[model samples]
Target: MQVRALARGVRMSPQKARLVVDAIRGRAAVEALAFLDTSPKAASEVVAKILRSALANAANNFSLNTDGMVVVTATADKGPTLPRRFRPRARGQAGVIEKKTTHITVVVSNDIEPTRRGYKRKPA
Candidate 1:
């Protein structure tokens, strides 16, 4: 059985969070935690917390062995953007500023093997 955890309205952009998520997907749970612990990206901190929650859910709720679990899927989705703020520009013009939010999900499973499809790079 796959166990998952979600964190909503995270104060980060989905694009930035995906950088960290893509790295940890398909890795062992313990290994993923280790990478997140040392990652410099701000998103890693949030992802780590959600990963821990998923492990806890598996162990406590589903009675699964977390030591053997692997990160099946880790993803970040764009969330509702906050109200737009405007800053005065050079000639009385307003500059729009958008504060983006994201929703992060991490799924771990001991029974299922993690598979990642390789992306092909186009010739320049």
Candidate 2:
């Protein structure tokens, strides 16, 4: 069975969060947690928390065996942008500042086998 957890309006940009999420995709839940623990990226902390929540959901809500769970899908999608703010610019001008947000979703499953897809190289 598959279990999923979502965190919306995260204060980080989707691009930044995607880097961390992509690394943990198709990895074992426990291993992904370990990777997040030592990761230096700021987004890792938030992703880790969401991963833990997914694991908990699997174990508690679905009564699944989390020991064999794999991270089936992990994604960070763009969220609603907050109101634009103006920052003082040169010559009394104002610069528009956009506050971006992200929505993160993590899915874990105990029955699916994880596979790693390698990058394809083109001939020179």
Q: State every prediction's TM-score relative to the real structure.
A: 0.87, 0.87
Error at 100, model 1, angstroms: 0.6
- Give candidate 1 regions above 4 Å deviation: 114-124
lDDT by residue for model 2 over 1-113, one digit each (tens)?
A: 78999999999999999999999998888888999999999999999999999999988887788898888889999999986889999999998899999999999887776
Runs of candidate 2 exceeding 4 Å displacement = 88-93, 118-124
- TM-score between model 2 and native: 0.87
Error of 1 at 53 (Å): 0.2
Pairs that collide, model 1: none
lDDT of 1 by residue, 28-52 (tens): 8898899999999999999999999
